[model samples]
Target: MIIRRFSGIILLAASLAACNQPQGADDAAGKAAAEQPLTAVTATLPAVYYDSLQVTMSAYYQLSAALVKADTMGADMAAAALKYHLDSLPVARTGLDSSRVAQLAGQASGISAELEGMLIDKNGLDGRRLAFQMVSDQLYDLLRVTPLKNTAIFRQYCPMAFDNRGAHWLSDKTEIVNPYFGDEMLHCGSVTDTLRF
Candidate 1:
């Protein structure tokens, strides 16, 4: 009887230990993750495409920064550089897989067209900002399909831009620097999406 009693006590202690132990570590982890900011996930791209995108995004970032500072000439120059890179993209070059290059090239061509408009737009800074928005949209679409590894691209939106029509732009930073309003309203937007790979 004593042995049986001791066995029962041991079993009860085991049960109580388990009951007192942490029950939902996984649930807690999930909840923590849920509370965290979203990390944009996207399709992986080949090295060539990745390199090209990095270069293009670099120029686009420069253009955006220029606009944020209200530097019209700097923005124009950066746009020209971006155009050159887009134009020089070898969609069917040796070593690069031609299958995906055509599609990428098509998207890039559209971006180049938008940049051209920015280069020639005579409606002053507002016109250029509009053109930049178009370029940003194209880039955003392209990045959705082929995001570069180790890059964080923020998709920002401004409801007051374009006469309240609202607009979106991509930024390399998380801070809201309104390219549309420049110094007039430098921090006039919020990041709506993030693209990372």
Candidate 2:
């Protein structure tokens, strides 16, 4: 991801991806989150705004889990929820400088458009994956500015995605759940970066 200076340092969010479960994978995932519920953003924003962003992140995690399972219906549902959160983000109310606020707003807009593209009636599975790739990219940019409050977030990547064009996604865990290929290559990615907040 492109590194940008916010104040005097570069900004970032986390690393991740998740899809098809192996037996009790759901149990494991849930347990991990229960152990460390990263339910807020570090940005100085109103509580309601923070809750909105938290739900957005939750939806994104759901989308990733569905992708790992190659579950189209699930992905559709999660994408819709994500779109709502992205659209309603209250960036202006956040206690940040003009540049950072504008950056988050622009990225949120990009994320909304990408999620919409993913939900188009004719886009199908491949289209959804492609759109998710963009969403992941834009999310990465957005997270750079609006850091999530968590112990650690991993940035996962797969050079084989999109016919080797490559793709990246954020994860709360260190495991690799390749959303692009889902079950076919669920573990195809690797951790590229880790952010702790």
Candidate 3:
């Protein structure tokens, strides 16, 4: 009778141990799953958007330089260049769905119409200057509010070129120090500082 009781106690202990083992294993698996990082959404932006952005940025830089030079001719030329690029941007041929691509194309077309009116009116230097500034400001606001604001990929690609610093905008400054193009000096030394010629 003593042997039988001891055997019964051993069997109960083994059953308890078996139950506890699975709980411990489940806890470990749960921890590992919780610790794993989430996958990023794959980027699928259309190429036309990139082309438009590049053209717009180049036009902005050129217009800024022209403003500094006080060259109405140069400013007009750059504005015309901007208009041409904006007009010629092809509808997205790949990536995005048809409806989305159509919407983007329509927006581009509207922008092109506004630019065409500005160019055809021969609105003079001041008018062109104001329009250029407006475009630049709009692009800045768009970048702040859209993909640039939310995506790590955009942050990695489109580094900040300038930031307002007290009395001037400083450019080419960032935390991750680049060995080649270290902090670029601000070009606000004088009215002629940014003029190419």
Candidate 4:
């Protein structure tokens, strides 16, 4: 009777141990799946969306690089270039429904206006950084729905950029060279998300 009781106890312990092992493996698997690249989120978009987006992103990179180098004039020129591309975005090029395209255009128009005003503002580098922040927020929304193909756009953040409220920008590269702080804290941000095309 004593041996039977001991055997029963051993069986119960083995079952409990087996149950715990699978749960741990499952948790690890879940994390691995969640960490995968965001490439699968993109859908087929119109050619104009891709072309204009690429041009606009290139202009943004120029502005970011200029800020990193602390060149206000360069930033101005880059912002102007970005504005030009933003204005040229074709509204009819979206494969999405008309309502969705209109929504996208509305957002794009907001970004353009901010960029144009920033170009005229004399508030200097601080003002420009703030303008860039607005542009980034709007552009991020637009890109979320119309992602580029075969490319990875990184959304980066700098917690120290604007009065400690934080700021975000998109980059084709993963390296962080903060535009808000310029050379004061050039590498002050990190890649928050990698949106792959």
Give the winner by TM-score.
4
Q: Report the lDDT tens digits of candidate 1 across residue range 71-134.
A: 8899999999999988876555524356566666787899999899888865677788889988
Model 3, span 108-173: residue lDDT tens: 565555556656776665565445444543333333322221222111111112221111111122
Q: Candidate 3 — what's its lDDT?
A: 0.44
Candidate 1 vs. truth: CA RMSD? 18.6
Per-residue lDDT over 17-38 for candidate 4, one digit per residue giving the tens place of the 0 to 100 score: 4322322346447745764322
Tell me the whole-model lDDT of each prediction, alpha carbons only.
Answer: 0.76, 0.73, 0.44, 0.76
Who is ahead in lDDT, 1 or 2? Answer: 1
**TM-score for all models, in order of appearance:** 0.72, 0.73, 0.45, 0.76
Can you rank all candidates by lDDT, best first? 4, 1, 2, 3
lDDT of 4: 0.76
- Stretches of candidate 1 off by over 4 Å are 1-44, 93-99
Error of 1 at 137 (Å): 0.3
Cα error of candidate 1 at position 181, Å: 0.6
Q: Candidates sorted by TM-score, descending order?
A: 4, 2, 1, 3
**Candidate 4 Cα outliers beyond 4 Å, as residue runs:** 1-43
Two-way TM-score contest, 1 vs 3, winner: 1
